[model samples]
Target: MSERPDISTPEHIRQLVDAFYGKVRVDPMLGGIFNGVIQDRWPEHLAKMYTFWGTVLIGEQSYQGAPFRPHKDLPVQQEHFDRWLVLFRSTVGGSFQGPVAELALTNAERMAAMFMERIGFYRDHPERFIQ
Candidate 1:
């Protein structure tokens, strides 16, 4: 049997979230979108993100929030979502180096693509994100 790699840690997940937001805060492509949203609540937001990613990568159910539902209320467009994927991929690529990292980023990319596609379709239809 193939052994599952011991490739994830809470600290690693924290690093990824911190590094990703650090990049996002500076990226001209995505910075404006996150500019005012994360100013004072960056620490809390980061904590939530860490919990979310840690749960995803390490099976720790520390995350508690409905992120997508709030995102639906935001002023984000399809382009914003697409750019989020680009920035997220770039963030992961810049910070991690390993097979696990590769797998994680690949999965993240696929999920983001699927999310954007679905959201885009829903936005175009206005009948799905509601249901």
Candidate 2:
């Protein structure tokens, strides 16, 4: 097999986002929540993901939104995040390597950890951030 290339371009971000979500959409542990939340809207979701990754991984000033707000109320917990990180690490490992690739993995792990904490905080203190 050929050596996977490091992520370096807009197309590469798209490839990573697309491939990652393709797996997410079918993953038994993650699919239900994602599919339920995003039913019939995969295209829009994937497009946002491309822009999000492009912004995060390549310094594109395209995505602008509270990336965690939409997920604060999702019925996810530690196990969900664990599965997500596993799939994400697996995807990154299967596809690419190098600083940028490592950045992607690192960022994913951070995002998962942050999201987990935020979700718990939101659940416990709904009055803090919610109306």
Candidate 3:
């Protein structure tokens, strides 16, 4: 496989966020859930995502919102989180390489685990997940 470009700038973060969400918008498994909440405010949501990823992949402090609050009320299930990780991993792997990409994947994995645990997926079905 060809090597992916390094994610070293805000532009790269923006690219990853935009590309990833674009796929999410069209994904059969995740589209409905995301569109149900995002509705017509895709631009705002994408902007926030860019800021979130920027802060995550770099030291940018543009994002300042609760990451898990929006998801708390969503009717998301374990399948949804799994699909999200699948898409996210694909997006990062397709677009980036190097330490930043590794960090991005690590952060995403942690976020997924935390969200799953908080949503009771881990507690309810401890055998399904690996700690």
Best of the candidates, TM-score: 2
Runs off by more than 4 Å, candidate 1: 1-7, 73-82
In model 1, what is the error at residue 57, expressed in angstroms?
1.1
Best by lDDT: 2
Q: Rank the candidates by lDDT, best first.
A: 2, 3, 1
Q: TM-score for all predictions?
A: 0.75, 0.95, 0.88
Clashes of each: 0, 0, 0
Better of 1 and 3 by TM-score: 3
Query: Which residue pairs show backbone clashes in model 1?
Result: none
Give the TM-score (vs. native) of candidate 2. 0.95
- Against the reference, the lDDT scores of all candidates come to 0.73, 0.89, 0.87
Q: After the best TM-score superposition of candidate 2, give how far the Cα of residue 85 lies from its true spot, in angstroms.
A: 0.9
lDDT of 3 at 121: 61
- Model 1 score (lDDT): 0.73
Query: What's the CA error at residue 71 for candidate 3, in Å?
Result: 0.3
Q: Per-residue lDDT for 1-131 in model 1, tens only?
A: 54433338898788788888887888776787677766788888899989988777778999997756645545666677677777777766666667777777777777666666666666788865544
